[model samples]
Target: MSGSGSRTAAARAAVGAVWSSVTSACWRHWPTWAGWAAGGFSLLYGLLGLYWTAGGDGFPFAPVDPARASGSILEGSRVEVVAPIIAVLGLVGAVVAWLMTRRARPGRRSAAALMVFGWAAAIGLTVIVPDYTLIILVAFAPLLLVFAFTGVPGDQGGIGDILYWHRTNLIIVFVGGLLWATATLAYRRRARGACASCGRRHEEGGGPSRQTLLRWGRWAVAVACLAPLPYEITRIAWYLGHPLGVTPDFLRMMQDTPGMLEVGLGCALASALGGVLTHGLVARWGETYPRWIWFKAGRRVPPTLAIVPASIVAVTIIPAGLMFLWTSEARGTWAMYVPSLFWTVWGVALGVATIAYHLRRRGACRHCGQGPQPGPEPRTSLDQRQVRDDPVSAPGQRA
Candidate 1:
């Protein structure tokens, strides 16, 4: 029994060691090689586009039923027209991303062009090429897990419908976009004579100060918080049979529809939760965990804890929110989609807020030997307090 326990312990130790090494590698290398990753993804995606153009059966969007395609930006699109263009752009993007990967000798013209291409591709892939399917899918993930066991309700064909290839394609695009954006940011920093890791200029006066980001971050947080309120109100109103945006009959129909009201209520709740979390961007508890939970109480919150999810939601929802506005235009039901219109703003503001939060809290960069370089005095007492107690500043030691 003693021998067996020793062996088990050894095995566990080996597994833990291997896992730790793998995670450490990923953490260190992923962002560093993000440009290469983007190039690879863009190249592959472009190839896929070419395949679709060559009459692949699994073309996602175009050639779907007219009823389904009616309200989308790609409504009247054709495989022949769109696929080749997408392929060309993807190939171009791949090349641009590749070039931007390493800045061995930076020429202003070359850097400017590459920057434009990289940023454009990043924004387009994240914000334009996809739709609300990504955000909605993420939001409804819990329900999807349940549906997997119990099956989806109503005419909504099983889990396959929600997790369809087309929707999954949006996720893929979203991932590529994230890679591109990360790559572009790094490339931009390096090109502009700034630290690639922390995005701070090494000059006399560095990039935007912590205080500046905090002040603007609060404004961004406010916008992010408010943007979702309209949607939440309308969704809850519809759920409660009030029909704030639509007709009474429409509300009744929605209520009558299997799981519709429930979904609406879920969305409203999610929106409310989003607003609460967005507030956390500027909140004390956001930077440091409150003394409420059992574990990690009063600990400095990991920056990635706030950044990753917020960034995902922020970028994914732009297209999702715009879907409502575009669909309303196609169907001529502006009032019905009014609440969702602000989702675009919500996404953009949340993105800005997330960036600000990151900027404010990112204590140091190992690559650039950059600590949060101090600059001008904060405008407000609150800013002073927050800056003084910044987790990046003191780590476990609170000021």
Candidate 2:
């Protein structure tokens, strides 16, 4: 029995060693793995899309009807022919990314080129196959439920329908813009070790009072985030048969789609959670991870992680709000105008808040090693009196 137990222990130790070695190797070469995986997937999907398109059977890309205004751009010709070209580009990107990973550190030119091409492919794919693209705003399904329950004639019927309409080329433009901004920042960081915008390191300065701006900005963001909660709540109540903002007929229709209620509740909860997260922008937690997050606690937050998403949300909301205004006026639903107006305000406020947060936390110059300079000391009452009395000593004294 002792001999058998010793053999089992040895086997377990060998297995553990092997697993650790494999994991370590994978961790060290993650960029190569990611690049290969992305390349393979893109190539496969593009080929499949092209093959199906040639067969006269629409298996991948959505069939476009020549009659519709939106479909006209893709009608009569296989516009999806670009899929294979994009896939080839993706493969090239993969090679570049792999090369970058192999080097001690990726060069700025290589990284920038890879980022530009990768983002272009991603945006192009999204634009070409929007129906297959996952919608981030699906979380707002509950809010849409509210409109549906209220028997709003302009309500686009279901969340899916709304997403179909919302995922336009405009989204691609915004995402591309964000990708450019992030790539520029990454390149600057890797190349110069200085702030991308200011050229100098961000350091604490006594130049101006930003406390009031930050305080007000945080509150504004919180309010803006929570603004959609009322609609969400009413929608949830309607789902539960309380019928707050809904008609009896609408309630009956809602009962047919019981799952929608759960979805709406989830969205409402998510929105509330988002409101809570907005506070992190101005709070200490934004600068450093909270204690509850054990692994990353006290670690400084990556600025791009917060700024990119916030900026994207802000940009998307502005156009969406404008669209809402136009649609509401055309449909004569004056009440809908309020949400549109508020959405624009929210977008602007969130953008300002994000900028404020960045300004507050941006580090001092890594290049010149310059930090915030001390302001000149203010004169006290006694010092002011003495200076006034001693004129020769105060100004241009001839010694």
Instruction: Tell me, by TM-score, which candidate is best.
Output: 1
Give stretches of model 1 more than 4 Å off.
1-17, 66-72, 148-157, 204-206, 294-297, 329-335, 372-399
**Top lDDT hit:** 1
lDDT of 1 by residue, 66-165 (tens): 4343233665578898889879988998899888877586899999988888888887878777777788777878888999999988777788866666
Model 1 clash pairs? none
> Model 2: clashing residue pairs?
142-264, 201-364, 201-365, 202-363, 202-364
Going through the candidates in the order shown, the clash numbers are 0, 5
Worst 10 residues of 1 by lDDT: 374-383
**What lDDT tens digits, residue by residue, belong to model 2 across residues 127-237?**
332321222444344565785666434444554454343244334434443443443343334344444334453453533345655666667677667666564566567
Alpha carbon lDDT of each predicted model:
0.78, 0.52
Model 1, CA-based lDDT: 0.78
**TM accuracy, model 1:** 0.85
